[model samples]
Target: MLSDDELLRYSRQILVQQIDVEGQLRLKQSRALIIGLGGLGSPVALYLAAAGVGELHLADFDTVDLTNLQRQIAHDTQSIGQSKVDSAMARLAAINPQIHLRAHRSALDADSLAAAVAAVDLVLDCSDNFATREAVNAACVAEGKPLVSGAAIRLEGQLSVFDPRRADSPCYHCLYGHGSEAELTCSEAGVVGPLVGLVGSLQALEALKLLAGFGEPLVGRLLLVDALGSRFRELRVKRDPACSVCGSAHG
Candidate 1:
């Protein structure tokens, strides 16, 4: 049930035919986990918090750095040395005091990661590294949770949804397989700020749709964003029957 304040606060969203009062209430009852607090995580956190998701689990082990301000919209110059989780928590709480926020300031190991996924209704993998994404995907598959994954680097970005609950949905591992050894970080390859924000925004939108039980999710499809050319392309993806992480589970 939404209080008068909640109903008024999210009036615009609630006004949408697809997300009326019932969807607003559903958003209020959903729990989500956001991995990482960098470029991609910033907008994802902001939108989800503003949209009235009841509980948000913020997981990040890194501290804010000066270089992060270019795209990490959740932090400011004053947060240079603060933990990413703490900084994001402060911002989110200010946005919607009605929502509950859980912090994971330290890096999550296997057991902790699994526990985190189990506690949430869904997860957003905003992590930059391949290892973290792979680990997160495995955990989501094992826990049977839906994962909204996004990535941006060097003017290119991609967003996808992998739901263990959907038979045709492909987990991250199914698409990237072990990933490339030559993968480069934003620091090394460089990225346009808007690229990550765009991807993150879409990830948030997908999450909202899933939570509110509205429009179609990105499940089994990958959206490619080419910032340099301002073009969007979507590629159909299918679950791999032999995927190392999710194959056996689906089978």
Candidate 2:
């Protein structure tokens, strides 16, 4: 049941034909886990909280630094040096006290990750590292949970979802083939801040659609954005029978 305050807060979304009251209820009862607390994860966390996801489990081991001010919208000058989860939690709590926010101050390893994955209905892979992305993918596949993944670096961005609960959904590895061995940080190569916002906003949109059951999630297709060229390309992606994560499970 939505409180008087909830109905007032989410009225705009509820007014949509597809969402209405039932969709808002679904959002208020769902649990979502988001990995990473950087650029991509920042907006994903903020919007989901404001949208009233019942519970949000956020994971990130890093601390807020000066360089992140440009793109990591969840953190501000006041939050410098604090744990990313600590900073992000404060913001989300302020947005909608009706929503529950769980903050983890440290990174999750393969050993303890299963417990986190076990607690959520869906997972968002906003982690920028190769190893963590693979770990999150495996956990989602193992648990039959849907995943929304996005990335933005320089002037390029891409969004895709690996919904193993769907019969023909494609996993992350199927689109990227294999994780990159080269590591490039914004500190090194630099990035255009708004690029993260564009990609992160799209990620939030896809997540909302998945939660509300209103529109298509990016399960078997990938959208690549070339901000510099001012172009958008949609690539058709197919499940890899050899994909170790979704191969044997075969949803």
Candidate 3:
């Protein structure tokens, strides 16, 4: 049940036809896990919190650096040396004091990751690097949870959603083979600040739609953004029958 304060606090969003009282209540009951607190994770965390997700578990092993301020909006000069999860938590708490925030200051191992995935309604893969992305996909597949993955590097950004519970949905490993080893870093490649913000904000939007049972979630499609060219494209993604992570043989 939403408190009178909650109803009033979220009155503006609730006024929308798609998210009236019922959707607002669902938002207040959803639990989401965020796998990173950097560029993409920053806006994802903030919007989810402000939109009234009941519980948010933030996981990140990195600390804020002076360079992060350019794209990581949740951290500021005062939080320069603080842990990313801690810095993000502080900002989220300030945004909506009613929501629950859990901080996981380190990367999760296989067993711990499985446990964390099992505990959440959905998982957001905002982490950088292929290794972590693969690990997150494996855990979500094993636990049959939906995974929202977003990445931004240089002037390019991509977003996708994979629901392991849906047999037809493609997991991240299906789109990018398990053997692929390409790894890119923003520090080395240099990402525009707004690029990540745009992707992260869209990530939050996908999450809200999924949670509230509203518009279509990007279950088997990937959206690509070319910030330099100022254009967007969509690709139809298919599940690989040979996918090692979510294949019949794996099951």
Candidate 4:
């Protein structure tokens, strides 16, 4: 049941034809886990918080640095020395004091990651490195949770969703495999600030669709954003039967 205040606060979203009172109620009952507090995580966290997700588990071990302000909009110059999780939590709380926000300032190991994913209704892979992304994906696959993954670098961004609970959805490992690649950091590769915003916003949209049960999500498709070319492209992704994370072999 929505309180009068709740209905008033979420009135605009509830007024939408697809989301009405029912969808708003769903948003108020959902929980989300967002890994990383960098550029991609910033908008993902902000939008999810504003959308009234019941709880948000934010995990990020890094501290805010001056270099991050360009794209990491959740942090400001005052947050330079603070933990990313703390900084994001403050911003999210200010957005909706009614929502619950949990901050995990330390790194999450495999066991902890699995536990976190299992507890949440959905997971957002806003992480930068392949190691964290792989670990997050594995946890989601093992727990049968939906994973919304986004990445941005050098004016390009990509977003995809993998629901291990879905029979045909592809896990991240199925697409990138466990192969090693040189790490790409925004500091080195130079990502446009708006590129991260665009990708993260798309991730939030996909998550909302999944949680609210409205539109079709980007379940088996990867949406690519080329900010430089000002174009968008999508690729259909299929689960690999040999995928170590969510394959028949794993079963």
Q: All candidates' lDDT scores?
A: 0.95, 0.88, 0.92, 0.91
TM values, all candidates: 0.99, 0.97, 0.97, 0.97
Question: Lowest-scoring 10 consecutive residues by lDDT in candidate 3?
Answer: 178-187
Candidate 2 minimal-lDDT segment of 10 residues: 172-181
Collision count of model 1? 0
- List the pairs of residues colliding in candidate 4: none
- Please give the TM-score that candidate 3 achieves against the real structure: 0.97
The weakest ten consecutive residues by lDDT in model 4 span 242-251
- Candidate order (lDDT): 1, 3, 4, 2
lDDT of 2 by residue, 195-216 (tens): 9888888888888888878887
After TM-score superposition, the amount by which residue 40's alpha carbon in candidate 1 deviates from its true location, in angstroms, is 0.6
Model 2 clashes, total count: 0
TM-score pick, better of 1 and 2 = 1
- The segments of candidate 2 whose C-alpha lies over 4 angstroms from its true place after superposition are none
- Tens-place lDDT per residue, model 3, 102-199, is 87887799998999999999999998889999999999998888999999999999999999878789999999885455576888889999999999
The true-versus-predicted C-alpha distance at residue 28 of model 1, in Å, is 0.7
- Misplaced by over 4 Å in model 1 are none
Best by TM-score: 1
Global fold similarity of model 2 (TM-score): 0.97
